[model samples]
Target: MALSLSARLPSCSSSVFEKAHKLTTQPPILPFPSNLAACGCTLLPASMGVARRRRQVVGAVEEQHNQTSVLAPKQSPSYSSSKLVLVIGASGGVGQLVVASLLSRNIKTRLLLRDPSKAISLFGLQDENTLEVREGDTRNQNDLDPTIFDGVTHIICCTGTTAFPSKRWDGDNTPERVDWEGIRNLVLALPPTLERLVLVSSIGVTKYNVLPWSIMNLFGVLKFKKMGEDFVRSSVVPFTIIRAGRLTDGPYTSYDLNTLLKATAGKRRAVILSQGDKLVGEVSRLVVAEACIQALDLECTKRKIYEINSVEI
Candidate 1:
């Protein structure tokens, strides 16, 4: 009877089946194999086989459950609905545009700023169901609540001062305070596994310029930005640093798609001239937002930097 039971059990996927097959003993008798002619010793082989298959199916189900539970955390976003993005500095110039772009994509957004009232006024009536505004100061580590960033997959920071102390992008830029400490505090608070990060910084900060006027220019602006960039790059978190040249308040427009992507390859730089470049260009904002999402999706832009400039498409 046991021989009949072993022969009837369907094969399992792994080599464990070979061992099961090698066992010569009359496999342990099933408790309820009743139709086998009243006496266990006289049970029909067919009836015993059916009971064996039932047991096989039960064991298979349990094995599958264990495998799935072990693999759940390792699965990628391609297989899951778990996506959370935290856009810091949502109250600022570029941040507002970023927030709008995120909403347009129908993604739930969490904005962390020093004040929620300013953001509420800027964003107007938001879909209470998706938009969440959490008040937190990035510069103050104690003020940052990890719970606010709990499930965040991407962190986009457009948190630098728009103008230097002298009202220039480079003039009297406080790299130590806003760019250095502020960014350091924020990065320190982030989890090592937080994958995507996009930081909006100014181009031309590769050199030093103590002059009040020059300090607002890229040369001076770069120092502070470099500090922040260094912190982000050194951290375990993957980062994307975007150095934008000469921000203006110009109109929105699109660019040649291929040309835009091509620009990222070489260490090329373009001046965002006042004529066509403005901080409010709809195309630029859209492009930056799209690039950010693509970076997270492709997993190719990890730990890289790129620059954005205005040019004729």
Candidate 2:
């Protein structure tokens, strides 16, 4: 399954996966970042493969986004009726997969996205009962109306942006805003009755100033992400943060339809979930997604934080 994630991540799409920063004053030699969140996974419709076709150009290359059109279409995911999951950033790599996985499980899901129309193209049309789309941006508190959270039992916030500057930041959606402001607003907007909020954060969030992570933190993504995690921890909402390593799976949005349908978790099927930020290797989007869903039901995961990575072994 490890191989499955890496194998799928090569389609060459950019990450709008958001990150954040917060320079602490205590015992500060360099800015000490906070606890974390990060990337996610891909699960095709449990019955069908899956569909999220978007054309994107990354690093001077335009991926063949429609190659999958020639292939057979995948079915929507299945989820449970007893639970309602509100998925923020439902259009991202991890977010897309999380939605796909939820659908496969037959769970009722509501997606909060900038463009509600993308839902049709990404996850495919669904019964209003199974999937609902709300138009909103996390950065704006005005967009997060209280009614949106009314029936939401749980939430999976996979929202994020690239660590460095990219087109995804066109709207001034920087880590400071998306990671910090966006998350803070979302956390505050969440109903006190919420059962769980699974936050996907990056691995380096806890050590943005240390070595390699510092490189990625040149943009303060790790630090800002830490701030976002802090908000969730401080909020009354019960939550779990899943920090992912340098992501290495297809932004599947960039791959040919054929590849997505055939893609499966490779050798890296087993997952390693450590409480401290000790694991520093890459993780599969699959593992990340699985961890998010699993945490929703695991009592021990409540109010806890973990870093997730997957391996071939």
Candidate 3:
């Protein structure tokens, strides 16, 4: 029952990951910087057990990357040989970053997309073992065949649409369909042994009927998203729900996987994590992407719902 609230964040940066690595390797004593201290922010320390688990997770990725780098210096390194991650909505803003990060870590990834050709255009060609693409629509239960979940130990679902009507809703992909029904269908079809399901949700769901949130929920997006979250919670599958703020940063729709891998957070390098859904602001798609990847292996994140946001240092 871990719940959290966070503010908006900028894009992703390698420094962020580097700092995270350092946190795991060193003693878990994180002190707020002078600027953050002036803002009256506080930092929390992870228990030794959590630190060890974090270290193992980060160490494994680095070790795998080192080994693969030596063998294939010219190609992207494949690090995690045991985990197969299935990413839904891999073509979207956050989803693209998630896939790029996963591939960069050398983790095996499978994508469920309506147009398989998009995978080719965005990610370019790849070894089937490293990046596999499957054509399917979550709105259709039949589209979520059992085979689609084969070998998929983890799932990061970033499927979403605009709060208001737009071209994305062309195929009856409304909030009711995409957010609620789509999520319900996917959850029902998931394999019983799936390790985790990280769902990207919106922040105002709990108070969708209240003022500003009500305005955004004009078309029921927040309401449907809450429904989706509830369904996932009721299931027995291990899950982590990341409630994001108004998303900022690029959708990076036109960028290729290489460009995506190099994406940065610019000035937004600081992240804030908290409990309760009390914060509200925009968040970088990159930050959300990184959060999903990190949550996959962090034991503390299991069966928890966290709201993530970022601020300038």
Candidate 4:
């Protein structure tokens, strides 16, 4: 869980930026202010200036769309009162951060991983009051402890393996196992009361082809991921599917958040950029965690699939 917080800064390089440029998709709708910083990303609204600016920009976009983007009301039903969230695959970069961010907000978190002890050293999480780690895996439904989901309101699946392995070897089979069937198994294992599920998925999975690229390429990835996405979409449960841009262990930087959602409202993509893999600016895993948490509480985020990448801040 602490590993999630460890990624917080920026560095700059043209090659990295070029890779970033090629990797980035169309931007989010509202252009984020240039002055915004990615540091302290999870708790931005604590600053009235940032909160005010966010409201103004979101309001502008909504007005332009002739549609409303409503957050759960101030008197919204206290789903947070459920107190616990079960984050599957919580040993990974995104899942670990999801756990940390939830715990940082004083929310109870039950992290499920294949090996809890392994994650202990990897995540550097020693905070007993804020976190709990359990041994489990998506492939083995029987391994999950039902008590973990007793009063849980939301679930996040960060189950897929990082794609670098596939890139390194044409014979790799991790993606098919982890991203495809593994997702189906996770879905089958969910509790009926679980209200929200957010999946961290990659962009271009729907585009890349398998010929020159390996069978594990994004296109190949998309072929399997799309199956999983479709399964989630068609399930009785509500869900949010996130197609993320290039991932980096980079520093936190300002990024415009949503694009497909913007385009659906008749707007073009807004160009956004975070510091690429360096300390100047980047997308913090912590921010992504918070965004997923907030998504569970917002009507605007329900039953929707959105994309996130660096945007002009």
Candidate 5:
């Protein structure tokens, strides 16, 4: 049966980098990065970064021994069932957080990347069954084999290149190709049974030719992204298009934080989700990633499109 993508969507159950999406058969997970469970707590590599924090945690635990047994009181988290998520652009800012949050939630994840080593470097070693890595650029169809989506129930595509001419555009990985052609190719190859495809797009997609948006759309990044969104809408699969504002902060470092992922955005401000594509502002990569995760599990957001930005308190 053909499913029409929703034009307007109600807010999904959400929070400040916290919120859980239910519904799925338990599969696997991609541990959130933070040692404290905010994603990136295990960052900076162990060289000069560990001893200080380790001391803090250990000291705190010891000092609080008369009361809360910090380590002992913490029990292993029981996880709910999850659908398999195929994440593209896994090394990108939002992509990493999504992968990390999925892992933290014990949800199975597969990453399609141009460089698989980046996954290991950014996310560290993970159980192959729970976190699988494949190498393929969205711009290359030959690399996107049918086997890649074999068990993928949900897909989050955050792949994108620079907006203008730069080193990042080398090898024809330009907006026209990466944002438009790449997305078109991916939608064309998606399996029929796919539950949802959440695409990370930009804010000015609708007004690319207008004033401020036109400035950013010099090289047609917004235009191409809109093209991608349109293609997905036209496709048979269910879909959600998350149009994000100018991104502010960076992607959180990922880690094996095996538990229900919450506050994945850390100390970021409140996230504001909007409809009608009227929102214009900056948002953290964390909020974008969190919203994407929420949309995947929200029935109201299915086949819907949304624009999101963050506010500082």
Candidate 6:
């Protein structure tokens, strides 16, 4: 498989500078003294000299701007008003970032969370057309009503739990219940005309029974994740699966949408994208969240499975 490596840089508000051609002028060759002529040099008029100096300064500024543009993040075009994206697990790490980014782009967003009140605390109040929060849990098939997906063009599922049992497993939300059963229920509830479904899964699912992965899968997290992936593959809905490596960066659970929008990968901004289950290492949660959003519109990503990782650059 081909390797897709990308660098994520901080965005700048500076406008792009147009390339400026070098300004050249031939100074009139005037008569000179014998000693001056010996060097074969001609002096430019005082005004021309000043003009050249100004050009040099302008050229330097343009060069700096060009460099900044190369390092700046690409601004994504605003999505169409018709695009209503429903985000499952909207309060989770990657999910929150996805929601914040979609809102920033002015895309209509619908969030399904177990606690509807959390939406107000996280994203604040918004117009009904811009954001709609519904109360539901994927673990309960009854909550996967068709109306929850009405007018939703895209769905991003970021729900998942810890590999080892912990407080997250409270209320019987185990790997089998949340990862496998929850995803299965969600996919089944998707509409036939859905534009796309981006599922966030982990890297070691394919190798869960192997050595170190087996240790992490002792509680069957990886196994259930793979089961969820298979279910989506068999479904009629167009889908993309992003298997992220060990996730780094913040969950930012306490922060509001404004803070989540500003979250960065710090030094770990270079991304490694590949097919198969070959890539190993860590990826920033922000990178994973961005990938899920990007995949929604890229035709080439449809029905594809990608393994992602990141490195400090």
Which candidate leads in TM-score? 3
Off by over 4 Å in 1: 1-81, 166-174, 209-220, 250-286
The TM-score obtained by model 6 is 0.76
Q: How close to the true structure is residue 84 of candidate 2, measured as C-alpha lDDT?
A: 93
User: Each prediction's Cα RMSD?
Assistant: 24.0, 13.2, 10.6, 13.4, 11.9, 16.9
Which digits, one per residue and each the tens of the lDDT, describe model 1 over residues 94-213?
566566545544567788977677655666657765578888877677877778788787888877764445453353335565677778988888876687888877654454463433
Q: Candidate 2 on 16-60: residue-level lDDT in tens?
A: 111111211111010011110011112211112112211111111
TM-score of every prediction relative to native: 0.58, 0.73, 0.76, 0.60, 0.73, 0.76
How well is each residue in 1-313 modelled by candidate 3, as lDDT tens digits?
Answer: 0111111122223223224433433221112232322222223222224344444334323323322111121334335458999999999988987887777677889999999999988888888978999999999998888999988999999999989999888989899999999999999999989999999998889999999899999999999999999999999989988888888764558446555644544433344443356557666676778778877776556787776665432
lDDT tens digits, residues 1-313, model 4? 1111211212223212223234444223112233222121111211124335455445334423442211101222222344677788675555655654564456777778776775455445456655677776665557665775767778888776656554523434366676777788777767898888888765555544733334447435656776787788778777876665554432122111111011110121122233211111234343454446655654445676655543221
Compared with the true structure, what per-residue lDDT tens digits does model 5 show for residues 125-144? Answer: 77898889988877888888
How many clashing residue pairs appear in each of the predictions shown?
13, 44, 7, 22, 16, 0
What C-alpha root-mean-square deviation, in Å, does candidate 3 show against the real structure? Answer: 10.6
Worst-scoring 10-residue span by lDDT in model 6: 14-23
Error of 5 at 43 (Å): 28
Show pairs that collide, candidate 3: 7-309, 8-282, 8-310, 9-310, 11-265, 78-106, 79-106
Model 3 residue 75 distance off true place after TM-score fit, in angstroms = 11
The ten-residue window of minimal lDDT in model 5 covers 1-10
Q: Looking at model 3, which ten-residue stretch has the lowest summed lDDT?
A: 1-10
lDDT of each: 0.49, 0.64, 0.70, 0.50, 0.65, 0.70
The local lDDT score (0 to 100) that residue 241 gets in candidate 1 is 70
Query: Which stretches in model 3 have alpha-carbon errors above 4 Å?
Result: 1-78
